[model samples]
Target: MILYTPLAETDIFPVSEADLQKRHCVSHNGKQLYVEEMEDGQFQLLQVLSTDPNDFMNTDYIPGTILR
Candidate 1:
């Protein structure tokens, strides 16, 4: 099947509501982050939700970094 829309894939086929509920926002080292709770009692970084361009320069903020 072909998709022809300017919208992002996630916008076309959105994640489940339950999955969205599992995700949350947090602040670490003065940076705002979007993370998801893992089954192992740790949080996995989803996205760096910061407006500061400098925050994206840090490798630690890369998506999928596990947090305690």
Candidate 2:
């Protein structure tokens, strides 16, 4: 597979050590979530890892929603 874009590779796929450290995988409401730690000590939802389609419909698990 090849991507033919004028953007630099970093611009397309950025990876920062600090960003990685700030992110965590946690279980919430019996579902796995990828979240980033916020300055307020809360977590911002990044992605939902689940097979159930209904899990994605839950408001609490929406991307960008803050979690305790």
Candidate 3:
């Protein structure tokens, strides 16, 4: 799984499987963030800010890499 620190002015890191299971991270704005790797090697960001979870759920998965 890939891990990104959007607030950090550095490149993103590819998380090790062991670290992904053990490490916890918080965002710069103090929100708790969790990363999970999908079976397809894509990563997901959890606990994101959104006005509607249902709308988000209805939307198609946009394919793109996160830039650091």
Local distance difference test, each candidate:
0.87, 0.91, 0.43
Q: Pick the candidate with the highest TM-score.
A: 1
lDDT over C-alpha atoms for residue 27 of model 1: 89
In model 1, where is the ten-residue run with the lowest total lDDT?
A: 8-17
**Deviation in Å, model 1, residue 44 alpha carbon:** 0.8
User: Candidate 3 residues 1-68, lDDT tens each?
Assistant: 56655653223446567755743344423433444445565456543444655534633322232212
Candidates, ranked, TM-score:
1, 2, 3
Model 1 CA lDDT for position 33: 90
Worst 10 residues of 3 by lDDT: 59-68
Candidate 1: C-alpha RMSD after superposition: 3.0
Candidate 2, 1-68: lDDT as tens digits: 99999996558999799888999999987899989999899999999999999999988898999998
- lDDT winner among the candidates? 2
- TM-score, candidate 3, is 0.24
Error of 2 at 29 (Å): 1.4
lDDT of 1 by residue, 35-68 (tens): 9998887999989987888888888988889988
